[model samples]
Target: MLNEEIPDVPYHVNGVEYERGYYLADGIYPTWASFVKGFSCAVDKKRSYFTRKQAGARKDIERTFGILQGRWHILQQPARGYEVNQMRRLMYTCIIIHNIIIEDIGYNLAENDWVVEPVVRMQRTWIDRCDTRKRRTKELRDSEVHEGLR
Candidate 1:
C-alpha cells in the first residue's frame, strides 16, 4: 500500500505550494517526497525540536490505533469476514461507533470550536495525468518541499 501512488492534491504550507499530500513515516521508509521522516540524530536545536514533535505526533497515532483495537477486538484478531468489502464496512462501523461514544461521553475536544468544511471534489481531466518526465519533475518539487519542511 505504501508503494502505491495516489492522485496529486495541491495544498500550501507557509505560502509554499506542495504538489501532493504527505505521510508521517519512520526512518525505515524511503526518503520519498511524500514521506516525512524525522532525523535519526539531531545535532541542532531546530532539528531536535522537529524530531521530538514528529515522534509525539506518531505516538498519538499509535495510541489511537491501540485504543481502537482494544475497543474493537475483531480488529486485533484475524478478520473473519469472507469479503474485503464486508471487512471494510465492519471497520468503518466500529470507527463510527467509537466517534459516537466519544461524542456521547462529552469527550470531543473540538465539538464547538472546529469548523467542518465541505470537501471540494476536483475534476479529473487529461492534463491531470503525468508522463514519466512530469512525474519526475513533480517528485523533485515534492522533495524540495519535504526538505524545506525539515
Candidate 2:
C-alpha cells in the first residue's frame, strides 16, 4: 500500500511544486513519505497546536462515518456480501438515497429562515502524466510540505 503509485495531479503550493496527493494517517502506519501523521507526543506549544488541529480534523471524519452508519444501518456491521461488486452496489445505492433525502429536506443551518447559495468552483477535466525524475522530485517536495504542515 505504501508503494502504490497513484496518478499525478500537479498543483502549486506556496511557490513549491507537487505532483500528487497525500493521505492523513495515524502513527501506526509506515512513514512512507506520502502519509501525513500527527505527532504522537507533543512537547512544545507549536507541536501541541498541530496535534490538536490534526485530532479535530480526524474527529470530523469519524463523526461523518458515524452519521453515515446511523443513516444506513448496513454500514454499521461488516458487510455480509462476499463479492466486491455486491458491496459496491449496496454502498452506491445507500449514498444515492442519502443524497436524495438530503436534497428533499435541504441542509439544516443555524439561520433557520435563510438559505445560502452554494459556491461554484472550476472543474478540471484532464489528467497529465509525469516522468520518473519528476515523480521523485514531487515526492521530496511533498515530504517538505508535509513537514511544514505539521
Candidate 3:
C-alpha cells in the first residue's frame, strides 16, 4: 500500500487540512507521516487523553479479532492455501454469524441507541505517477509531519 501512488486528495481534521492519510499505529512502528502513534510518556492532560484514547481504540480492535479467532477455529490458525478472495469471504461469514449470535443473545443494540460516526471519504482527482518510489518513500517517512500531527 505504501509503494502505490498516493492520490491528490485532502482531508480536514479540527479545521486542519491534510492531503495524506495515516494509519493508527503503535510505538513499535516507525515515526512516519502515515502513522499516528500515541505518546509513550505523556506529561500534559491533552497528551494523556490522546494516549488513553489511542490505547482504547487499539484494545477494542484486538478484542474484536480475539473474539473472532476464538469463535472461528479457522481464523485462529494460519490461512494456508486460501486465496485472497476466499479469506475475505471467510472473514465476512464469520462476522455475519457473529452478528447473528449477538442479535439472538439480545446483545445487539437498537438502531437509535447506536452511535454512528461520520466517515471521511476523499475523492482522488489525480495520481502523481511522475513521482519516483524513492520520493514517495521520503514523503511518507517524514518525521516532521508526524510530530505535527501528533
Strongest candidate by lDDT: 3
Ranking by lDDT: 3, 1, 2
Output the TM-score of candidate 1: 0.62
True-structure RMSD, every candidate: 5.2, 8.3, 6.1
What's each prediction's clash count? 0, 0, 0
Off by over 4 Å in 2: 1-7, 12-15, 79-82, 85-149
List model 2 lDDT by residue over 35-78, tens digit each: 76789889999788978887788887677557777876656657
Write one digit per residue (lDDT tens) for candidate 1, span 1-150.
122244556677768876667788788876668678899999999899999999899887677667878876647767764488888787678667767877898898555553435555555655554454476556744656677656
- Residue pairs with backbone atoms closer than 3 Å in model 1 (clashes): none
Candidate 2 vs 3: which has more TM-score: 3
lDDT of 3 by residue, 27-142 (tens): 99999988989999999999999989988898876787788778666476578878889998988887677678778989865574634355444454445443545677787899
The global Cα lDDT (0 to 1) of model 1 is 0.70
Q: Lowest summed lDDT over 10 consecutive residues: which window, candidate 1? A: 1-10
Model 2 RMSD in Å is: 8.3
